[model samples]
Target: MQAEYGGDLTQITDLDLLAFDFNPALRMRKFIGESKSGSGKSAPKALDRMIWQRGLRAFVGAEAAELTINSKVTEQNRKFGRELGVSVQTLSDLSRREEALLMAEVEESGSHGAAAFALVEWVRKYTKSEPELEVIFRFLRSKVWFLDSFTAVKQTISVIETLSKQWVVGHEDDHKKAVRWLLAEAVSVFSLMLVDICSEARLRPRFEFDAFVAARLADGVVPSSEMKQLSKSIDKFIAGLLVAAKATPAVRTGAMGAFDPVPPAYADSFAELAWRLSRWVRASDLPRQIDFLAHERIGLNRPVPTMAAQRIQLSNLNFQHSVSLVCAFLRGHAALSPDASETLLNLAVQPEETMSDAVPSDADVASPPPLALKRPGSGADEFRGQDYLDFNDPD
Candidate 1:
């Protein structure tokens, strides 16, 4: 049993120390040492490491983090350590623990805390082998983490819309699967990053999820318009193809039916949809989303119910679509809005409703099942429609 990320000095935290306490009159206590670690002989950098560890503890969802250095920390650094909940120690502490009695205590608790992250690592791992998809893979790994959820999702949609032009028509199932798999993984990655960022922001009195997200997405500057023409071109390019269909093609042909019949919550354009999603996220509801995703991952252990995808005709998928299916659940329930939900559909221009009966009917999907069952003791019977919040309803 190795410590999680224990040997990697490059990581922000240390999970190796295995802490313990002794008490004769009561049960002995043992603590697993977990924290992000960075090295610096200079006091200021050490403080920065402490701060980074604080976020890592929350991101990894660890009970505690410890930062140990070769030299003692400054008096001021010690002060912040106490406030930040990091345990700071020097090299000499190991000298006090060369005896067998201490080893017995350490063994009693066995604080290797892999449970915190073992769940996520187990559910899914994507293998990107297609030469065309290399650009998509690189963007996900390199760019998505640094972005806000909205922009991250938007960029995801945009990139696929661009790459998908080369896809053969018969591969619509493959396309939808790929699109869904990417979005599902994106949500998981983005949510985990959100946990790290949100945990750090909690230290400030004025922190807001929206503002923090907006600032980060902007990266201290205005957002870009470089992709606007690209998005417009693809949407227009496909709209023309839908009209030129001389004979009925497969349900998946022409403009991708994957994104078509824009959900009632969408604003008909990418920019409008972005604004709608920006307004829907709030801190209080954010945890519910996290818990929602966690339980969602938990549910993947079982096989999906029959006819689950309904008219969309999605087959009972494996680990790849698990997180994304949960996200689509949230979108249907109005947790993640429709505009953002399109991200799960791979962000292509949807075909016109008249063009395809293969996709879910506009009215049929107008009400997907709610995100959850009614609570333990509540008799609330309100219908949670796709039009629940009434964002883009044409009144």
Candidate 2:
């Protein structure tokens, strides 16, 4: 199967391509061509020529190879550039200002963009420190700090205002209150994680979570029973958060003035909440009842508690179900997942056409509705009732 962008199996093909053609001497020197790597031969030569045509070079260790002159490199470079935005040539030839702009643009494109931008920045800063590069680096570093601080302040004030309003209204069950809290938590957690992840800015072409997850699981000493418990807790927490988010008004309008729509901070809040919730779940003991419930929902034909009862085997079915549930919840709040967070950050840095397209109209904005739990199995009856209530009442 072709490797997806973020999948674990995805090789750093870009790096291999870079080394093979851009620095053939180095490739020959380092690997000695003894290894049966697929990229060691005619492919890199062709890619090199293609990249040379586009006026970009693959920058390899203290030297750069022009793409326009290298057919093999050029073809490969163009293909990668089409999806990633800028070609290898464009990245290498970019002026400090242009480089910054391109970085911002890539960051806006998607999570891949964010990763690429970080890699480029790291390379430009560490590989060779020209005066212009230093200036750009300093500016970027400062901008990142400013952006983070600004987001923190905005989030803090918003949370304070939300709490004050809840206090004044004295409506504890208000759906908006729950939504606001969820949003706040998500933002806080996301911000912290973003900072943590970006701190280790390396030129990694692919994002692999397997190693990270494996290390974390090992650190926690997670067992099969514990994993099941963690999954259940995460499911409940996510469900609650989603319920709250759905209830919160999307827009609020009053006689005096109209409140601005809730920002994407709600999504950020969700991501952050998930991260923290994961920690607690990881630590909790497995709940036998919840595991059984999950097994039934997912359809596992594993044996029930057998043997002397001192050791009841919790099947992998429960763990898998829990994972599926968490993934489903994350998908529902796709805009708030870690992947989405990266995309949002990129967008903030470099506004894209899609982001512009999603901009809402004045009338389209409204606060989320109250959290009305639908009775299970009611189906169309519940839908009709909600529709009637929605038409009959306006808040």
Candidate 3:
């Protein structure tokens, strides 16, 4: 009855507290009753086993449905009917115990989707000796949202890059200013969207300035000193670009009076190949990818399909490459900052600690393996010492 009432649920820290919290027997009865009434379309038993073994929160509903259809004594899924009686309780218990805690933290943060992602990883790693799951979840969630925001900004930059190419190539001076203005606005949106995404997670305590610093630092793209200096320049550059974009039509028209040649559109037939490279290479190799693109230009009068192909090729770069490419473009055509260049350069040589996917725990390794860096094209073969690309400053 208490479970059906749907009152505000309190945290249950111990199994003892669960007794007073909800009637599991009644809940199980209702769940079983509902299972009997369903059409009983069951999932593969093996797939259900794999999902449960993985303990992924996103697939919890599917696992629950797997339990439901499996409960009915149907020919396709009778394999699970006997076990279903126990498995249903186990599934419900897993949800009831962790769901409230996870959801509460995510709700408080206001970035549920990203938080959900972090919580999954956190739950996978969290233990009694580890930091509180909530703290870990929130911390990782901030980092995850920063990554997501970075991706969004880069996607917008791809569009801006595409349109800018079109603007520069157009012989019509009448629309050149408008195109340049629109390009600038797109850059502003890139910056703003980054802020908006982080703010939604309450990660933007200092407007975008703090979050930007945090993201760059977390990504190990730049040292604290360089980021501090670079952040100021970046703020100014974004504001200046926005101002340039918002300039009066008369001023914009006057600015574009000089003959400015547009870069020729590149063909996208190579897009698929670029995608393959992006997937294979690490973030540090993104600049080289841009260099690869610089040589891939096609004639302005290339067929529509050819232009579309090139656009896809450019878009296929990894998220880091996309971000770096945008920064490279800005350095060439807009604000040229040593700080920006330094920061972008640093992205390729991030400290090992910062770049590592998992902190090596005593529980993780019986005999700790030597630290090594994997070469771009190498598969499962890592070597001692640094593996620096020609473009990356190993130091």
Candidate 4:
């Protein structure tokens, strides 16, 4: 864009709150916002802001705009805004939304926000005094959103295959460095997990959580469709063994099936929610859900989450969907059983460990843990768990 224009877009695109989500058509659905505080004469007026914002919506190709001001929004002004395709947000509206999101565990400090700024300062300070720190800091910046989310993430994901090794090699000498370094690592991991999640949706035409999830385990080693077929083959082979063991007088069918892996913790309690999620992904609600996730992130933390994605490649629908999926999952987290929560914590709760190790080599990723394939002894009613796939499948 810079080369095409012969100038940096940094100045022209300064319209506040230009957030976006991915779609197949334009490949982006953008929301622009303009905000001002205080109702004094010197302060920007609501009508004026909306007028300019409407123009900006066209200039940047945004589909929506929100104009926020301290003054009361009159009916006439609201009508004009509606005609102009910009929505109005008063201070009270923002407050109510924030109140809704307020949680005991959420800190006053921005969610992973201040840490990023501090790391930027720390890096600048170190590099100015120590020339040797240049390469490391550059590498670090390449991996982090410190330089900004869009460009940096593009660079990071392209080289994501080597991310883990690079992380293992980085410095973590002092307390501050270690903490900041680890935070960066976690953010990168967040990006990886996000990418893998989307990758599943991209690789296959149809949507099924288990198939893509299996590919995720493969660590991007095998095509998702192939992995799904491979898993089916494995299950069939195991089922044949189950029948064979029953034919032998000495052998017990249950003993032959003893090797069946236990379902992941909370697989039962999570079955309903997980099934809902899969259905939503495959349903019309997905676009709306993604839109809500994009806008809600801005409402949740002004700059924390969006900074990691803003102006990044629009083709990164996987990242966007993964983010929305994770947000949806986390939103329902409280409803999970306590043991399930503990299992999640013990699992890769940290951003750094979620898809922590980068894409695997030619070596295959293990298939998703299969549910117990019932042999002859148990009735279909006795069988239960996460395998409740589609409406067509026997419940």
Clashing pairs for predicted structure model 1, backbone only: 12-36, 12-37, 13-35, 13-36, 13-37, 14-35, 34-65
Error of 3 at 374 (Å): 56
Worst 10 residues of 2 by lDDT: 25-34
lDDT of 1 by residue, 1-395 (tens): 11334555463434554332322211123344433243454443557668877886665444566776665667887778878878776555544553433442222111112432343233223334564455565565445644554555445445534433442333445444454334444454444433334332333333343444443443322332433334456666665676576535552254443322222222122222222322222322332233323222221211112222221222212111322433544453324434434333321212233223366667857744323211212232222323222324446
Q: What is the C-alpha lDDT profile of model 3 across 1-395, one tens digit per residue?
A: 11334558663311110000112111110111122222335533433542342342122211222232233233433345334432332334445766865543323111124543353344435422334333323332232223344444444445454545544443545234333323433443343343233222222223343334334323333444555566666656655665768977565445441322211122121121222222222323333333222212111111112222233333332433344444555555433243423332232222334333588687655744323222123232222123212212334
Q: All predictions: root-mean-square deviation over Cα? A: 19.2, 25.4, 23.6, 18.7
Candidate 4: where are CA atoms >4 Å away?
A: 1-4, 8-10, 13-15, 18-29, 103-156, 159-165, 168-395
Cα lDDT of model 2 by residue, 331-357, tens digit: 344323333222112111111222344
Q: What tens digits encode model 4's per-residue C-alpha lDDT throughout 60-143?
A: 667989988898888888899999999987898877876786522232223234453465566567665555344445555432
Q: Record all residue pairs in model 3 with backbone atoms less than 3 Å apart, i.e. clashing.
A: 267-310, 268-309, 268-310, 271-313
Q: How far is candidate 2 from the true structure (C-alpha RMSD, Å)?
A: 25.4
The prediction achieving the highest TM-score against the true structure is 4
* Evaluation by lDDT, superior candidate among 1 and 2: 1
Task: Give the clash count for model 3.
Answer: 4
Where does model 3 exceed 4 Å of error? Answer: 1-43, 46-146, 163-395
Question: Which prediction has more favorable lDDT, 2 or 4?
Answer: 4
Q: Considering TM-score, where higher is better, how would the candidates rank from best to worst? A: 4, 1, 3, 2
Assess candidate 2 and give its lDDT: 0.31
